[model samples]
Target: MKTTERVEQAFKRIKELLTLVTDWTKQPKEEDALTKEFREKKLQLIEDLYKQLGELNDRFMFTHESEFKTKEYVVQYDALKKKIHDLEK
Candidate 1:
């Protein structure tokens, strides 16, 4: 796939995972077991997507510095990490 397509896919996956987490958070206390399970799965999916995004960013960095700057990727990755960390808490 093209670089743009790959980036778009990664973003789409991130958005989906975020939505799942948000939905899981909105559940009531009665289904704590199911909610916790869903949250754990969502967190795992987020981590996997974050790793894929990092790998794609690295590839982009190697191929096109002008289009995909490393510093911007680093900032975005750090922000993502912070968001994930907050979710874990």
Candidate 2:
């Protein structure tokens, strides 16, 4: 895919995953009571987040051309990175 498309896809996925993480975080849980199901879901989300981060990093690594440095793509990449950071926390 083109750089813009790749960034857009990553940004979209990050937003979707952020919603999932936010919902998961808002659930009520007992003190230090990490249930098996909750642990499993959290682990899965972390894994998915890491995968997305790696893909975004890889795409940016090879994308040094000025053509791909449009204002829109830069904004999308920044948003994607920020969302990934939030999800990580």
Candidate 3:
């Protein structure tokens, strides 16, 4: 290939790479904490809260409808679990 053609091909590759990365970061999605430690801590806290709430129910035999509703928010932590990400930056 001519020198001009080689340079043009290189520029094309660079442009493609820039486009790929640019589009990827354009939109941000709601995600749990980026760090493993934080996610683990949050997960742990959720488990602890669940266990304590269970113990409280066992001791007091909860009957109120609102008391049952309190556990609904704990489901939010299911998606907040520490996912073992395989992708490298």
Best by lDDT: 1
Across 1-89, the per-residue lDDT of candidate 3 in tens digits comes to 99999999999999999999998888655555566677677667767666665665554455566655545535533333322111110
Each candidate: RMSD: 23.0, 24.0, 10.6
Give lDDT tens digits, candidate 2, residues 11-80: 9999999999999889666545467777777768767767776776666667875645557466766776
Q: Top model by TM-score, which number?
A: 1
TM-score against native, each model: 0.43, 0.40, 0.36
1 versus 3: better TM-score goes to: 1
Which portions of model 1 miss their true places by more than 4 Å? 1-32
Ranking by TM-score: 1, 2, 3
> Candidate 3 has which clashing residue pairs, if any?
none
Which stretches in model 3 have alpha-carbon errors above 4 Å? 28-89
> Ten-residue segment with the worst summed lDDT in candidate 1?
27-36
Local distance difference test, per candidate? 0.81, 0.74, 0.60
